[model samples]
Target: MKGEKMMKQNQQDTPLYTGLTRFSQQHPISFHVPGHKNGAIFPELAKNTFRDILSIDMTELTGLDDLHAPTGIIAEAEQLAAAFFAADRTFFLVGGSTVGNLAMILAVCSAGERIIVQRNSHKSIINGLELCGAVPVFIAPEYDQTAGRYTQPSLDTLRQALRKYPDAKGIVLTYPDYFGKAYKMEQMIQLAHTYDIPVLVDEAHGVHFSLGNPFPPSAARLGADMVVQSAHKMAPAMTMTAYLHITGKLVAKDRVAHYLQMLQSSSPSYPLMASLDIARSFLATFSQQDKDKVMTSVKQVRACFGQGNAWQLLPATKLDDPLKLTLHIKQGYTGFQVARYFEQSGIYPELATNTQVLFIHGLQPFGELEQLDNAIKHVNDQLKFVEKHATIEVVNQFPQKLDTLAIPYQQMHLHDIVHVSLHQAVDKVAAEAITPYPPGIPLIMMGERVTVEHIKQIKHLIKQGATFQHPDIINSICIFADE
Candidate 1:
């Protein structure tokens, strides 16, 4: 609801969420990260411990070592992370995956070099493009009209791209997409390496994949050169706690270190760093046991949905993140309605958008669908809202246009772009990302010249109730870099 008003900006914004109050200097210690000055879950901590967080939120102390250029505790923390993920090196991110994503992109490719990338990647990747001025050979993902969503680009399409853009320095892929649709990593990675291009994976939603059954394998294990995961996404940890992994050919360990400095803050949060270290260590120690418990819970939830009473649960695979429970609301309850109903019951799903309600299962324990099944039935029995979902509409398979950044993409620069009203900005090169959210793929990056079809799609998104956010601006916008 916070960003409901900012949709016109063409950039995605955070939800209206309040910061949780933590233990103040006067409080005592207890939990992790904060080590908490002492231990007092402030009154607000009870609201959302994850939000209220802890005290002890400070820069690296003498024993802690620096995060930007670590040598002590931070280095040990990252080493432990690397061991857990089985990588040559692992950098802990107290910041979100965005910093790591940009760092990875900057580290892997020189400025002006082109990367064969998924157009559906997160907004962070757009920042990578802008910051490094890397020309992108965008691989658009598979669009689904049924749910107004998109899945990862097919292996077939990726191969086609690799074959065509032979000079692309490296490849960037997104594993276990926003909706939990995973790609065939084995195949994609194989294709990327055949050309000696390091595969950088934005596994922001993937940290929990290897730790659970219903989800897919880690892209790093499947052979990507670099992997970035938000440990906070599906794993039990504080927000902004993330991990960066390195593997395969051409990855200079020092370059990785350099970019971490380039993107990460000098004053890294000790508490957050400790949380990431604790989370990784925790994930290593309890991965199987925790995954087994999660698997059991998933089966129980599936049984509840199999009863076919109201809602239908989409059971994802080991190739997708298992904790992500994507469900289609049955009867008269919309996703939001069901989410709100759950919230009223003191439970909150991760997200509730137009047609799906996604609940993130984690290492934590909870009711194994017994309560959820009943609450859903109860909602169906009583709740009704104005948003009624009709039969799924299939997206038209339009002729694949011969669109590639190869032509204009190579020559464009970040400074040569400008933003304007979408209507007024017909022929100018884009200075902002014009991507469809939910699926998180860009039809046009910050410097790509828009085509008629691209413009049509943008207008369609505006007409059909999709919100667009311009990263730099806060109001209605159209973006094109200056000539």
Candidate 2:
């Protein structure tokens, strides 16, 4: 207990943030890049809002240290982060988890090499596969009826993929579903390790899982070879800030670094890096009392909605994160419509789907119970005048246990791309990934064949007023031109 206390005390120090603060205090003049000149040459109208932050948005100067070849404060900050996350080493990512996913795939697999991937992964994972030119063997995740969404793939499905592709370079997976539902990730990692296959996890939403109990375990702590976390997602950090952790020996640390250097920008943001430093400290010092307070506030908010007939909170599972509150709309209204009403009442949720709206709470106490209760009342009142739609039933869209791209990533450019109407797209190969925003999971990957079922799902989502990342999917879709 004493040792743990000492560790927390040590974590209280933020090296990079302190360094940046000290440097900004010096009021260094502008001979550097970023013509803002430390917010001196900023727009008059926006200067008041942007001045303080721009002062710290500096470049690589003495004591500031370069991110690619860190030797000073940057190294110290990353080292502290590694210790806090219990990783072999950790790299600060300015380009968000997208760059981390790309670096992990590029470092481990060569062109045409097979890599096992989860079918329900974020579009960034599919983009990484395209960039690395790796052939993907997709394992579909089992749909969770309780959560009303696709969670992690079953163990048997992973076992089959491993058996079929024992020579596969690595296995890539998303630890928690978008709504914070986790699965048996530890066992899945062990299963992949038995075949000498490294496991790379895109744990973008589970960065705070390291807080322990009440929060699900992070993939980094569960023996994954590589884990990428978007610190900005759950932590109080600037957007696009993330961490890439090297946790196991299966993957070469230097290779991961090399890819990150190649893929990331030469000029990184100091403010974002400092925020990453602060975010790590925030997690390292998060106390049990803090956790209890957060949960208590969350329960109080849940209780307010529970007493009303407007919403039904999704029943919590043992592995579910309390921060993620998914509410099922009970009055036969679409989540999109309900979310709009909440927005009108100045209450913004994380994201909304056909039947559910997801609310993401922070590590601190939920401070607005009265406002939330008022928003619920507003929704209930407004919903009375709106026409009710039939409740959208959840279904397993990706039913196949194992599937592969119709055209390999390397061969995608060989065919001519053409935009065709949805009717003509049947039995054709997709030339662009059709993904839903917010969750960012691809419904149809670029190299995959377009099936009638795919069209049906797309039409259903469009009819329900779901937002697609590529809005043109409603008019037409890009498909490979006839041989």
Give the root-mean-square deviation of each candidate in angstroms.
10.1, 1.4
Steric clash count of candidate 2:
0
Question: What is candidate 1's lDDT per residue for 373-401, written digit by digit as tens?
Answer: 77666655546434554433224322342
Worst 10 residues of 2 by lDDT: 388-397
For 1-483, candidate 2 gives per-residue lDDT tens digits of 999878788799899999999999998988988999999998899999998899999999898999999999999999999989989899999999999999989989999999999999998898899998999999998877777677889999999999998999999999887788887788989999889899999989989999999898888889999999999999999999999999778999999999999998999999999999999999989989999999998888778767545568997777888898898777468888888998998999999987789988888988888999898888888888987767646476777788999999888788999999997998999999998787789988998888888898888778878889886888899998964
TM-score against truth, every candidate: 0.77, 0.97
TM-score of 2: 0.97
Off by over 4 Å in 1: 1-55, 143-148, 212-214, 305-311, 329-346, 368-371, 382-402, 405-429, 434-444, 448-475, 481-483
Clash pairs (backbone) in predicted model 2: none
Q: How many backbone clashes are present in model 1? A: 31
Q: What local distance difference test score does each model get?
A: 0.66, 0.89
Top candidate when judged by lDDT against the true structure: 2
